[model samples]
Target chain A: MKLDLYKEHAAEYKAVKKPIFVNAAPAQYLAVDGQGEPGGECFEQCVGALYAMAFTIKMTLKAKGQDYAVSKLEALWYPPDGGADFETAPKSEWRWKLMIRTPDFVGKQDLREAVKALQRRGKNANAGQVTLEKLHEGECVQMLHVGPYEQLCETITAMLAFAEANQRRQHGLHHEVYLSDPRRVPPERLKTLLRQPVRKA
Target chain B: MRDRTRHSYEQRILRVLTHIQQHLDGPLELDALAGLACFSPYHFHRVFTGMIGEGLMEHVRRLRLERAAQRLKQSRRAIADIALEAGYGSHEAFTRAFRERFGAAPSAFRRRHAPLPVPDGRAVHYTPDQVIRFSPKRSSRSMSVAIRTIRPQRVAFVRHVGPYDAVGEAWERLMARAAPMGLLGESCQFIGVCYDDPEITPPERIRYDACIAVSGPIRPRRDLGVQVIAGGDYAVTTHFGPYQRLGRTYARLCGPWAARSGRELRAAPSFEVYLNSPEGTEPGDLLTDIYLPLMPAPGTE
Candidate 1:
């Protein structure tokens, strides 16, 4: 039988409107780096490469014998300095690495192999830039934001407040897992996982 | 000479498998599959049956149903819509076929679907103004990998129908028999075939075949069966070290890489080709090449 990770870890993926503190662990990912504000041509290019490479590698492995559910699209957002206020930072200055979590079986070798295949298929110009990376966000804060992506600052603010009340400070980049497909779902109905790594203030 | 013959055979079959997945939403006919493989329709049927362990139509039907089962659980699309997408012209026909395989009506299965159970407040802590809680851990290892094409071979094997984990007995017996025949050597490869989905099928009914590839003739013993395994396109990787790590290796292959690979999967059982004999080699030094057959990548034949 096929396995659905979302269903298997339903409690973990669940997020209410209210901000909550969560502890996360390290995981591997197929990641492509990009600079500047999101929703641009460059960001789309990175996402295109990541998804295409991901699906290709996925099919390759599935053909082998393993069964797994693909994790949602996620990103790590920050400034080059590693500390910048979302409100004060220039939109053009914002940089992020778009990613999809990969299973452990995939190692550097698979990533290297997928790069040439992806390039031959012309999946994305930036497809060659994708590399395997591991991210670990320890004690953190997260919330579910159900609305337009533009308005996510409201939810982020609420999350920051919760983190502040808990005597925690920002420790890592902002992370999000898109639970809704914006291409089909309305902005008001779109669901996104908003997270920020944190530590004791 | 043998390697070249095997490659050509796998190449022909790869095209047919590709055509099946690409045109599943459309009409799949004997002529089409035969054309894809560049074999006459009559010859194609015989070749497909010999290699796949089932008829061509049967394989297509099973694949369609499996794909439909996945969509029914994943999508909010209507049954009628899904049925049409499954190449069924009517809802009644689709439902009957679905019920026979899944043991429940499509809608009922959907209705029975439940998300993960919620954790209680015991794991959560309360603060002065806001509450503190831990989200479920989201961590898995992953790697980059590529697909491989493999050749079919004739093998001597002992068949065991039961739990997959208990197949060591069958291997022991198979080795005992083949070793006496002087078939044990460095070049002799071992393969393990699990013929059922453990997650969906009952364990008692699962079929496990432990096979040893043999180039020479051996008299058929009552305990062993001989057959030709058709070679085709496969995704290959090695599982290193002990058997316990096999689960993690599978998780790595199936979880992240499959989703990223974007290739369609057929109903073929995955087999492990052992490079080193476990009995003669250290557990940490054991190497097994896992071969998974794949349908051809889309947008190409």
Candidate 2:
């Protein structure tokens, strides 16, 4: 879990918190919450779902001469009260949010155009409503972690403490960049990059 | 027909040389090697010499003696066994060849070349370690990659025997034919596949393929047929140099990096994908991406 993705995409992760308006097509993803412990099973499901959506977007856009950037990705975890063992609970819930930016994000006009093209091909195309949001850019500390997702809590805590002691405030939600495809990589050797945007306090 | 079979004969000789190195202590003769190549001894010697640029017997003799010299200084094997395994009739004959090649007799060489002990008491037995420590570090910290999984390809190939420099003409012919088929493309890198293990393959019989990827299911046309290149995870590194220097880069990346990272190298064929042609760039400026397959080590979490 040595976060090979971050090492490979260091430049992209380093340029965070800058507002970049993006017009992205609608994508389907399995939303997950990050309130509870992030285990191996939870991470595998989350990444697999995200990759499928991203690949579909890339392929769809490439066919239409459009490029998009993954602007924001965050997982909201819902742990039980008192930080109880959610694993033993009857049901665990997670929510995953991804904001992808394309070249045109002014309004629903771009979405209507895409929907029209898909309808012509006789496909169930929902060019969902589009909105423009500010994507903040700034400096951030990142590390590649190779291990079970549950084990990452300790590392994340350490990183947060480091950031706090250094007078840097956490500016945005946390995001994990998937490097090795979970199917190809073993649970033990899976690599994910933990990136948290920060600004000078 | 003889011309068509010549390439196959060369490959057989290289494989035989690899086998000989693995069993250096066993008997190896021209007849035995000819049998392995499925050719008569009369034709075997001629074809081997023509492709490898040395007489078959002479090359084997030199390689065996060279390995003996290394073993003598590196290991505590009895000198008599080393001599016998080198195919020498006596210790005296082995010592003579050792001195001729290495400029020192076996006993004298061993005394002067005893391995140095590190602080942990492990002997530093390999010369490459010392060389790597002194080599300049790469300025860039990035690795190049082409995000594509190439399907299995059938190649019409010619195995080059001996040092790579002597086999340039043969490769030129292979590349010429492959190019017309549109088998070589920008996305598909031209590959030179090395099959023989360096430790065992004699220098005279090292095997290499000058190959390009083909478009479809290959039908054996004339003496050409298809061989599948399996798909898997590969550790890719780009090297900018003449083809002759590729082996050094591979030795550095695979031999050292894989060893240090505690990863096991899979038995898949490691190859160099040529990014630029000799016509487009000078030989020294050619770019080649070297791919080494890797797998997880046993019992590692």
Query: Model 1 chain B — which ten-residue stretch has the worst lDDT?
Result: B130-139
Poorest lDDT segment (10 consecutive residues) of candidate 2 chain B:
B128-137
Off by over 4 Å in 2: A1-201, B1-93, B96-163, B182-188, B202-205, B296-301
Q: Estimate the TM-score of every prediction.
A: 0.41, 0.36
lDDT per residue for candidate 1 within A55-113, as digits (tens), equals 55664555455656667788887655556677777777878989988777777876666
User: For candidate 1, lDDT tens digit of each residue in B1-301?
Assistant: 3344344445666566666766666767776676777654423554455444445666677667766777777789998988887778999999999889777877886787664123344322212223223221112444545687667788899998787778888886775565434444323467887565443346788788999887766567898889877776776778878765664555444423343455534446667887654542558767777665666766557
lDDT of 2: 0.52
Model 2 over residues B1-301: C-alpha lDDT tens digits?
Answer: 3333333443565566565556555667666776786544434443344344445566567657766776787789988898887888888888888888777788888798455323222211123122211111221333344323445555657667775566565565564444333333223346777765433457788777777565544455543445666675566778877877765556455433433334444546677777655532457667788776654334533
Residue A163 of model 1, lDDT score? 92
Question: Proportion of native contacts in model 2?
Answer: 0.00
Q: What share of the true interface contacts does candidate 1 keep?
A: 0.00
Off by over 4 Å in 1: A3-12, A80-84, A122-124, B1-301
**Candidate 1, which CAPRI tier?**
incorrect
